[model samples]
Target chain A: MIGMTLILKKINQLIVGLIFLYGIYIITHGHLTPGGCFAVGAVIAGAFFLLVLAYGSDILKLRKREEGSSVAESTGIFIFLVLAFTALIIVTRIFFTNYLPKGITGELISSGVIPLYNIAVGIEVAAALFNTFLALYL
Target chain B: MELLLSIILGLMILGAIYALFARDLMSALISCGIVGYGLVICFLLLQAPDLAIVQIVVETITLLIMIAVVLDSSREELKEKKAAEVKLSHFRKWYVMNVILIIVCLVVLLYFFKEVTSTLDPLGKHLTRMSTAYIEYAAEKTGSANLVTGVLFDFRGYDTLGEATILFTAVIGVLTILRVKGKK
Candidate 1:
């Protein structure tokens, strides 16, 4: 029975990891696919949920009792705004306009602001969701 | 053409009514879920996949949060009761309010939906028609595979920042509500 339980635990972790990877895949392919920042973020959050359920609150890596969660939440917001402000400043000063280069299409390096925006959004959403789960669960 | 539109409209109205009139909080919540599902259907009908994806995520999170809050509050109540003799007065009251709120919310949402769809401009039309070009352009520009990310972060990055801040505020609100003095 104990051995069975241990194997089940390992399988759970593997499943969670797969789910997390799937979320990343979805987020990264959001623009070209059916998923997006929100979908992928929520899926990533689901991975955490799976972990919490499998290991219980005590074993979860992202704890609700930690002050770091709140800090992380704010940091995502701060980073997003700082990046945006930087872009705005650079555009207004150097290029004489806010026009960033819209590079070649569908080659993993296009869309001036779209990918950066998606990533920022993904991070923001993941952190916010984790914070929410922690606050409620803890 | 009209038949399809009317079917969707009918589903929306029915979902709204069910969401509002359900007798239990859980049932009311389920109704809300239906409302959300209906909204997604409507979004698809309008051919707005981007908006639909965002809406699904937002709705799912909202539902999760609501469920969490409801679960947390109920635990305390459950502990104080013998589980058998517990009355559902609060649940009943919430249901009544839910219907009223759903009606009000549906009216508001329906109005906005009609207005937005009608007012879609030439630029909006062009963007949807040529979204592939934008997606391809975004991929080469942002060094990311996610086109939504490219557009949202690189082009309209400021809006994303604002959205992050709103989420941060919600986290703070949750913390403030749940935090206990002298308890880690």
Candidate 2:
């Protein structure tokens, strides 16, 4: 059982949602924004870690969380590799070519394969970092 | 901008000087982080946002790991040191001698640095062939307005893939090693 008090809980509750939204925004807008997959992953991981720290401890719950993160991390990386190889298979036999038509730049739905990579990487990073923290902290 | 750069450089220098005088290893480590963060600011001001972001992340992560290690390994070291410090009166003479020695070493290092820097190329003038290509064609080729993101996910995607794989591998390793209940 690890937690602080009412103030931390209240603040975390208010902030965690905003953090998740911001993380998603950063990931989705990675092509035009200052942040990319690495930043988004770290931000998302930080949000979840804050949420976990505020809640009272349960070893079983933490175990389940860790397991879930592991699965998510594996899936994220698998998607990344699969996407990369898909370009290789169907297109000009290039490993990381932009097979999908690159839409108008600076738009929400532009940047051919980058947004997908950003999403996949964000999942992997957020999961991996959160899992690392749980493993070490517990 | 020059004023800001000088101010940050001065801050970094002060942090280094403070580290020399810090009584505890933790404080010294934190002062060292101050220098790294100063460089982060420098990177941002120099239009190198990619370098700045990477430096900030690496600095923070490394600082966390190091603090954890220091907390774990430094408990008994103080006990041994207190045992060695029997007479404060005797220690004061040696402390002055150490200060003189440190000052001498810093002066020598600064002189060497001054000479070395004089021979280097000017700032922002030197651009490598790869970076030139990125600056020109990254947005067009990758369709990413953010040049850093363009280079990261498009040009050097293999590097990003390797980095993600390495992070995944490290997490898996940590989980395996830190399992609470496992088969014998």
TM for chain B in all models? 0.54, 0.61
Give residue B30's lDDT in candidate 2 (0 to 100): 96
**Candidate 2 ranges beyond 4 A from true positions:** B16-33, B50-77, B82-120, B182-184
Error of 2 at B57 (Å): 6.2
lDDT of 2 by residue, B1-184 (tens): 9999999999999999998777788998899999999999999999977677657866776677567668767823244555557666577869989889999999999999999879876778764787887788887788888988888888889999999999998987888888766422
lDDT by residue for model 2 over A1-138, one digit each (tens)?
477689998998899899799888888888897878887788788777677667744633774534788888999999999999999998779898878888887788877988899899989998998888777766
**DockQ of model 1 vs. true complex:** 0.42
Clashing pairs in 2: none
The fraction of reference A/B contacts recovered in model 2 reads: 0.66
The true-versus-predicted C-alpha distance at residue A26 of model 1, in Å, is 2.6
Clashes of each: 23, 0
Provide TM-scores for the models: 0.64, 0.80
Model 2 C-alpha lDDT versus the unseen true structure: 0.82
Candidate 1 Cα RMSD (Å)? 7.7
DockQ of 2: 0.63
lDDT per residue as tens, model 1, A1-138: 011256767988679888788888866666566666766667777777556645666674443446565665666566656555665576554321225466655555454555555666677787778767766565
